[model samples]
Target: MHTERSAAAADRHVGDVDLTHWRSRAGRRIAGAWAALGKRYGAMPLLLLTLAVGVGIAVLATWIASEVYDAVREADDVAVLDRPVLDWALTLRSPTGDRLVTWWTDIAGTIGMPIVALGFLVGFTVQRRAWTPLVLLVAASGGSLLMTIAGKDLIGRARPPLSDAVPPYESSPSFPSGHTLNATVIVGTIVYLLLLRQSRVVTRVWTIVVGTLFVLSVGASRVFLGHHWLTDVLAAWALGLAWLALVITAHRLYLTALHRGAEPEPGALGRS
Candidate 1:
């Protein structure tokens, strides 16, 4: 009877060991699957590549724009559309027209203010992170302002004559419009952030519509207020667009990295 009991005990011990081995093997397989998925679809590397290309394009556009601006300033009646464009921009001055133009500009400019507010709101509403979009927006605004100042200092292009009734506080070169650049940055970033958050198509459509109206109104206001030449507004629009592209590229990379469990890169906030 004692010999039989010993053999039964040995058999039970063997079965327990087998069960432990099988469970260990299954756990490793599960861990390997997760690692493989991460390796295949992470967004970090793509973000880095996009940022490099965007910065390159912005530099090229700014350089070419400066050269073209200088050439036009020196020539008499060059292939420039300064006066004609300005005239078109300013025709909305009949009593009713003035009201319409004023209303649009005010309304459009107001749309950008919420972005500043939204930056703070993000901390409460989304991630509870304060420094993210706020830092980016501030950086974009400062970069635009600095570029405007530098361009004005280098070119020193004159405004139209006294008959044109230049805008109050207008000074320096008529090459790039600062107001337009500011408008673009403020409106552009807001639209970008909103698109990322919203799921409904209608929300995205409204965001785009508001952003477009804001940018156009700000650029047009510069001409209407006689603060910038038509070319100035055009250049600012182009330059601002280029700046915005770089900013967006950087933001995309940051977001991609973020999605990939990486930290957001410095200088990806749109500063030069």
Candidate 2:
């Protein structure tokens, strides 16, 4: 009985070792295959990876936005808070506050946001002499505009009644707040570009803080001015963030590919 037990124990130990060894060998084979593919294809693999991730982000955003749209259409869940929030905003209104918010909000208006983005793009192009800022701005703005137009047209959500709105009332469909979405994308992209050039912790922190404040204030202004419901602004925030993530991810992947393909500088090797 003792001899039989020892034989069984040895067999179990041998099986465990063989399993681990097989796993190690399989892992090495997979790694070797990936390395060989990378060498042969250069940056194509990175580009393909970026494209896959971008598509996933877009699909996820679309799914979430659709859920919000359905809820709004059904007037349940988040849609229930719209009227209460709008009523609260109505109570806080004043001539001075309206004027101030209108002025600030206009800075992110359809016309205003494009102008601001263009000015920044030109300045960054001249300063950095690179097309990255332009690419980021265009991608961010274009995607934001497309999503805004599509959401508004598809949802066709009505804005607050004209009686409740501030002067110079908007006539467009107001499901996803265009002002809020544009502000988020443009401001976010600009901050991202700036951070790429900025190394100081304090400066980066301030940049992020200011950018966040600008986005929040714009979304709030839309509600306060009676141009959009709370849910519209919320949807715009989520959609804008999704688009921004896609842009940043693509940019990061591009940079990774560039760095991976570049040769080492003289005397730089082994220094790090």
Candidate 3:
């Protein structure tokens, strides 16, 4: 009886070892198959997903901007606040404050903002020895410019009267403030790109906070300087966010395609 029991126990131990070894092999094979499947069929799905997200953002932003336009055109309830906001902004103005705000707001003007964006692009491109950064910057800033032009021309909303505004007046259509929109897109994009390389928590936090403050300050400066109505800045913020979403979505798809072993596009981010 002892001899028979010893043989059975030995057989059971061997069987247990075999089972564990089989399980380990099966797990590795499953993981390999999954990775292979992703490499084979992931690009198209990623492209489709990004397209859906971009379209959704564009549609929502357009709808919101249209609603604001209609309100302004019809002098609806929201439009009524425009005058009061401008009046209040005007009340806050003084010689020193005007100079400071004007100086700050100019940093986001057509010439100034482009210079700022170009500097960032050049610096990043040189540091990484890559053109992806430049490509992304161009796509973001170019789209923003086109959107600003279309919005301003479409709405043809005039700026607040010069009498109510500070000196160095603008004559452009003011439904969407170009300065605010451009600043938001450029600064926000820079922050997004910066965060990709940053691992430290403190650095990431400061990047986000500073970027947010810059965008908000640019928008507020537009109102305080009398270059745009309150609604103009609001609409610009909405539109800028939408464009930024589209840009980031495209970048993500690019990265996903590269990960799946798809042929890389020219100037795609190698480090990403």
Deviating ranges (above 4 Å) for candidate 1: 1-61, 75-79, 88-91, 95-130, 166-169, 263-272
Give stretches of model 2 more than 4 Å off: 1-60, 262-272
> What local lDDT score does residue 180 receive in model 3, on the 0 to 100 scale?
92
- TM accuracy, model 1: 0.64
Tens-digit per-residue lDDT, 236-268, candidate 3: 898999888787656554443444355433333
lDDT of 2 by residue, 1-272 (tens): 12211211222222123211224576556434433444456433443455455646664575568666886567677657899999999999999999999999999997788889999999876655444556568767877877787788777888999998998899999879999988988899898777766657788889999999999999999999999999889988988888887776565444433333422222111222
Writing each residue's lDDT as its tens digit, candidate 1 over 1-272 gives: 12211211222222123211224565446334422433454333443344445545655666677787777767954335777776675665465765565555554343545555465446423432223455456556655666676667666777765455332344567767766766776678667655655567787888889888878877887677566677877888888877876776455434433433433333232322
Candidates in order, TM-scores: namely: 0.64, 0.76, 0.76
lDDT of each: 0.56, 0.71, 0.71
lDDT of 2: 0.71
Count steric clashes of candidate 3.
Answer: 0
Which window of 10 residues has the lowest lDDT sum in candidate 2?
Answer: 1-10
